[model samples]
Target: MGVTLTDSAAKHVANFLQKRGKGIGLRLGVRTSGCSGMAYKLEFVDEVNEDDLIFETSGVKVVVDAKSLPYLEGMELDFAREGLNEGFKFNNPNVKDQCGCGESFNV
Candidate 1:
């Protein structure tokens, strides 16, 4: 399966894009950094690349590069407001381990 966004996450992204005024969707990718050797990267997409993979949920698009698909496959993007903290949460089934600070993970 590909990446998907929860309703709240999609709403959050959609609102952000609406405010920004120009974006096709959101891009999800992986980067080699942090204590666990891999980290999640998210960005707004104004243009779709030729090799990009796009998944849609709740009317919002979740884009991923081919290279990042394996690690991010079957992941769920969630938005939550816990107390004063608000952010996107990645529920990745492929993640075998993650760092203590919760900034990074490894398959």
Candidate 2:
């Protein structure tokens, strides 16, 4: 399994990249932080390292570094709007626990 973006998420990223005018894809990774010990990080990629792994879905590229792959494998990212607030949501099957605020998780 590999990382993927839902249709809405892909559309959002693609639109942002078009507006920015330069990006090869979105980078998805994990960092050690938060109460649960891990948090997701996302950024638009201008360059991909040679060892990076890329997964394409819905016309968008989801890139991951080798070290982050195990934790992010099979995760699906989604964009949702609830009232006036909107953000990306992580649907990670490997996660076994999440912080109360929902910003971090542990597997």
How many clashing pairs per prediction, in order? Answer: 0, 0
Give stretches of model 1 more than 4 Å off: none
* Backbone collision tally, model 1: 0
Q: Which regions of candidate 2 fall more than 4 Å away from where they truly are?
A: none
Question: What shift in Å separates residue 36 of candidate 1 from its native position after superposition?
Answer: 0.7
Number of clashes found in candidate 2: 0
Q: What lDDT tens digits, residue by residue, belong to model 1 across residues 4-25? A: 9999999999999999999999
> TM-score of every model?
0.98, 0.98
lDDT for each residue of candidate 2 in 1-107, tens digit (9 for 90 to 100): 79999999999999999999999999999999999999999999999999899999998999999999999988999999999999999999999999999999998
RMSD of candidate 2 to true structure, Å: 0.6
Quantify all predictions' global Cα lDDT against the true fold. 0.96, 0.95
Q: How does model 2 score by TM-score?
A: 0.98
